[model samples]
Target: MLVIRGLGSQYGRISVLRSVNLVIGRHQLIALVGANGAGKTTLLRTISGVQKASSGQIEFDGKDITQLRADKRVKIGICHAPEGRHVFGPLSVEDNLHLGAYSRADKAEIAADLERNYAMFPVLKQKARLPAGTLSGGQQQMLAIARALMGRPRLLLLDEPSMGLAPLLVEEIFNAVTELRKRKITILLVEQNANAALAIADQAYVMETGEIVLSGSGKELLGNERVREAYLGI
Candidate 1:
């Protein structure tokens, strides 16, 4: 469903992504795991078109989107729930969710999807009228994911969905991600929690210093000796 080839991006004069190549088949969950400075988030940003590519090409369903505007990308079914759980602080939780569907004109389907998200994250329904900033960190994370789902994304780009949450909440978030997989929501998850991410992914890639170092099925990478020593700490 998506293809990236020799992709490169930079911040000012410094390079962040170097010749990164990846592919995601429709309805498959793909995970990209690496250390803090490995440029995973930058890669997601570039693919989502929030950051411009310095070189290479990105194609979605065979059309080149490397030069498309970010909103245009949304119209083409690329929705990103970026890292940091960025929710509008003053907006009601429901409003934040509604904003996700801003690019669509289908009110009936949008309403249906809203209910679906509420069913997925019950707390968001409970706090429908509350300010997003008042929610707990885990609650805010759930809000972010649910908001993204409101866009009815074909390929969801989730960045650090479990960052800073408690262990139980982390488990909860991962379980929700698994639910997305079951729903056939194509995901390219950029996660620091290598174990959980790789375990749930159908296919996974190891990124190092802005480039893909290894690619394999999730189970294969999980048991890989080098992966265990470096990322898994086992």
Candidate 2:
């Protein structure tokens, strides 16, 4: 559903992504794994239109979206859950979720999506009136995912969804991501936890120092000698 060709980006004068080429099929779960500063986040931000690409093309559903603004990208069904779970601290959980649907004009559809999010994340429903900051890290992560779902995204960009949580909570978050896959939500997951991410991904790419060095079926990547030695710690 998305294609990126010869993608390059730089922050000021420092290049972060170099000639990155990637293709994601509809309803596919693709994981991008690498060490810190590998430019995974930069790639996602560029695709989501938050960061401009220095060169190359971004195509979504056969149309070029390289020049589209972030909000315009959202209207075209691309939603990003950034590295930090940046939920509004002071806003109630429901309000925060509601903000995600701001691009839509149909109240009934928005309400239906709200109900669907509540069903997927019952905890968010229970804490609907509570401030988002009051939730635990895991809960906050769930809220972040649920908030993004509120936008009814066709392709979801997840950046480090399990970053700071405990092991059990991390498992919970991964389980939720697995459920998203079952629901046929196309995902471009950028994660540091290579093992868990690869386990759940249909396809995986390994990046290092701003370039894609490896790409394969997730199971193949999990067993790769170089991948095991470098990222999996096997």
Candidate 3:
């Protein structure tokens, strides 16, 4: 469903992503795992059109979106749940979700999707009237994911969904991600928790110094010697 070839990006003169190539099939969950400075987040930002690529191309469903603006990318069904769970602090929970569908004109479908998100994250429904900043970190992450779902995205870009949550809450978040895949929502997850991420992904990629060093099925990477030593610490 998505193809990236020779993609490169930089901040001023310093390069962050270097010739990164990847392909994601429909209905698949792909994980990208790497250390803190490996440029994983930069790749996702570039793909989502928030950060411009210095070189190479990005195609979604066979059409080039490299030059498209971020809002235009949203209209084409690309939604990103950023690493920090940057929910609108002053907005009510419901209003925050409603903002996700800002590009769409279908009220009925949007309402239906809103209910679907509430079903997925019941706490969000419970906090419907509260300010988003009042929620706990885990709840805020759920709110972020649910808000992205409100956009009815075809391919969801998740950046560190489990970053600051407790272990049990991390499990809950991963389970929710699995459910999204069961619903056939394609995902490209950038995670620091290699074990948890690979355990749920269908395919996984290892990134080092802004380049893809290895790619394989999730199970394969989980058992890989280098992966275990470096990322998994096993």
TM-score of each: 0.99, 0.98, 0.99
Clashing pairs in 3: none
lDDT of 1 by residue, 137-164 (tens): 9999999999888888999999999999
* Candidate 2 lDDT over residue span 1-234, tens digit each: 999999999999999999999999999999999999999999999999999999999999999999999999998999999888999989999999999988989899899989988887789999999999999888888888888887889999999999999999888889889989999999999999999999988999999999999999999999999999999999
Colliding residue pairs in candidate 1: none
Span of 10 residues, lowest total lDDT, candidate 1: 144-153
For residue 140, give model 1's deviation from the true position in Å: 0.8
Instruction: Report every candidate's CA lDDT.
Output: 0.94, 0.93, 0.95
Of 1 and 3, the candidate ranking higher by lDDT:
3
* Cα deviation of 111, candidate 1, in Å: 1.0
Candidate 2 residue 20 C-alpha distance from true site, Å: 0.4
RMSD of 3: 0.7
